[model samples]
Target: MDSSSLLKEYPLNPVVWDEMCVQNEVRAPYHKVYEFLKQISTEDLTRKEEMARRLFMNQGITFTVYSSGEGIEKIFPFDVIPRIITAAEWDFIERGIKQRLKALNLFLKDIYHNQFILKDGVVPIEMIYSCPHFLREMHQLNVPHDIYVHIAGIDIIRDADGEFYVLEDNLRTPSGVSYMLENREITKRIFPDLLPQNNVRTVMQYPQLLYKNNPNGLLGVAGLMSAYRKGNVAIVNAPGNGVADDKAVYIHVPAMIKYYLNEEPILKNVPTYQLNNPDEQAYVFENMARMVIKKTNESGGYGMLIGSAATEKEMEDFKVAITANPREFIAQPIISLSSAPCYLNGKLQPRRIDLRPFALCGPDGIEIVPGGLTRVALREGSLVVNSSQGGGSKDTWILSK
Candidate 1:
C-alpha cells in the first residue's frame, strides 16, 4: 500500500505542513537524512537490507543462540527504520529515569541495612520476607562505590493515546544496549535519509557516555590500576547481580531497600504473594489455575507455569512443589503485555514487545540513553520477549523532527 493508503487504513493524523516549514528554518544536522528518506522508494529499503547484512558482517557483530545442539553464533538482526527521539522528549525521559534510578539505588542500600520502609509500612515486612531476591548474604557487603546499581534498564511503552508508562525495571544484568548502538549505525548507513530533518541528536556516543566516568574518564588508562580500580567499568552483565535479580531474590529487594535506604519506594511492585505466607500460600494452593507461578532462579521464559495453561496433573505437581518449599516460588497475576508494529515476513504486523532503555549512574548523576532496545515477541500472540526464545528486535526512535 502507498503511504497515504496505509495512513487511511491505520487512521493516523497527517503531518502538519506548518511545523515542517518551521523545522526547515533550522540547519539541522540530520537534514541530509530527512531529504534522503523522502526521495527513496520502498524498493530502496528492500535493497538496503543487503547493506545492513554486510555492515553486520564487517563489524563482526554476532550473538550466540542455543538450540538443539547449542552454542551457535549468528549476527544480531537489524532493521533499517531508525527510531527517533526528539531532544525535548529525551530530556523529560532522561530526568524521570534518573530520579527513578537514584531512588531505587538508595532503596537497595537501605534494604541491606535497615528496615525503615518496611517498618513505616511503605512496603510490608511480610512482602520482603517472601521475596526470593532478598539476599541475606548481601546484607552487609558494601558495594565499592556505594552504588548498588551501576547500570539499569527501565522499560517504557507508549499507549494508543501515545503517553508513556513505566513497564518494569531491570536493575540487574540488562542486555541489548549494544544493539541500540549497532542498530543506529546500520540505519544511518542503509537509509541515511530516514533520519529526522530536525536537529536529531545521535545516540552514537552512548557507549562513550556509559564509559565516560570510568575512574580514568575518557583518557585511555593502562594496565593494573585500570583493572584494580573499584569503579573500573565495562558493560558486561552486572557482576554478582544475578543473585539478586533472580525472581527469588526480588522478594527480598523491598526488605533490602527498607533496611538499607530508610525511604519509601516511589514505585510499587506488581501484587505478588509469596508461597511462604501461610494465608497467601493456602490461597495460591487452592486457586492454582488463576495465577502465574514462577521458579525463583530461572529465566528466559523457563520454569514458568501459567495456571490457565496447566492441566490438573501439572497443577497438582506445582502445588506439591510449593507446599514442600514455599520459599522457592512466588505467584502473580499474568500481565497482559502491550504490542507494537514490527516488520516480519516482509510486512508490518502487530507483535508483542517490550522496551529496555539503559541508564548509567556516574559521579555526576544518572543518564538514561534515549531510544532503548525494543524487543519483539516474534510468535503471534506470545508475551515472552527474551532473545533466547524466538524473539526479535526493532529500532526505537525518539523523533526529534
Candidate 2:
C-alpha cells in the first residue's frame, strides 16, 4: 500500500500500543482486516460508515443522555472497522473475568454475613461502613444460589505495554450489552463478507444465554421487597450489588480473589490510590495532573476529572472537592489505552479504545460471550471511552482459531 492508502495515514505512537499494527506492520490478528482495507477505496469506506449510521437509526439503536433533568436521545456512534481479537486473547479475558466475578460474589456474601475479610484486616471496616452503597439491611440476609452478581460488565483496557488491566467492575445494573449485539448486526449490514471470511465467533447467542437463566414467573412490581424476602422473586443483580460497585471497595479486589479463592489474580487492576489515606492523598495532590480522579459511587463518566486534560482552575476546584470528602474519591495514574485504526472523514486515524466483555453468572456457572463491546475514543488524542463522553463503538471479532 502507498502512503496515501487507508493503512498508511494511521500514525503509530511509540508510547501507545497499537492493536492492529506494530512498527508499520499489521498484527497477525488484524492481518486480514488490514489487507481488506488496503483494497477498498477511501470513498467506499466512507460510504460504509454512512451506511452504519443509517442502519443504527432505522433500528433504533440509541441511548439517551440526561442533562439538567432533560433526556436527549442520540444514535449511538459506530466506526466502520471492527476490532479483532485472537482466540488466545479472548480465552485469557474470559478466564480472568470469571475468576474476578467468583471472588466478588464471595466477598459480597462474606461482607454481609461473617465479615471475615474485614475481621482479618484484608479490607478496612471503616471503608465499608462509610460507603453509601453498603446496605446495612442486607446484613445476614440470605440470597438464592449465593450469586450476588448475575450480569457484570468489566471495563478492561490495554496499557502501553499491551498488557490487559481491569479498569473497574460494574456489578450494579450494568448496561451496554444491547450495544454489543447491535454493533454486530450493523457490521453484518455494512461488511457482509468480511465476518465469514475471518471466521469471527458469534455473539448472537447472548440473548439466548441470558434467557436460559431467566426467572420463572415474576411477582407484581409492587411488594418486590416482600417477595424478595420470601424468595418468590430473585433479583438479577441481587440486592447490595452496589457494595461491590463502590470504587473504594474496588481497591481490594485482587486481595479478595486471593482471600476467597486462594488464587492470585489472573487479571491485574490499574494501580489505584485511596485518597482517604493521608500519605496517598498528599502524593495525588502533588502529581494531580498525571492522574484521573473519580467519585467512588458515581458512574456513566460523571463526577470525574482527567487531570491531564483539565484546566488549572478545574484542577484547583477538584482538589478542593477531594479535600472536603476524601473518602468519596480515588485516583489512578492515567493509562495510555491501546489504539486501533478508525475511518474518520475519509481517512484512517488512530483512536484509543477499551473492551467491555459481558459476563453472565448463572446457576450453572459463568458464560462470557466471545466478542464484546469495543468502545472507542473517537476524538483525536482523547482517552475517555464512555458513550456519554463523545465515544463511539465498533464490533469486536473473536477469531475461532
Q: Count the backbone clashes (under 3 Å) in each candidate.
A: 30, 0
Provide the lowest-lDDT 10-residue window in model 1. 11-20
Summarize candidate 1's per-residue lDDT along 317-337 as a digit string, tens digits: 988888897777888765555
Lowest lDDT 10-residue stretch of candidate 2: 1-10
| Candidate lDDT (C-alpha), each | 0.61, 0.90
Pick the lDDT winner: 2
Q: Compute each candidate's TM-score over C-alphas.
A: 0.72, 0.97
- Candidate 2 residue lDDT tens string, 1-401: 23455556678898999999898888998878877887878778888888889999998988888755788889999998899899999889999999999999999999999999999999999999998888888888888788889889999999999899999999997889999999998889888999999999999999888888655535347988788878777788887889897999999999999999999999999999999899999999999999999999988789999989999999999899999999999999999999998888877789999999999888899999898899999989999888888998989999997
- Native-vs-model 2 lDDT? 0.90
Cα error, candidate 1, residue 22 (Å) = 26
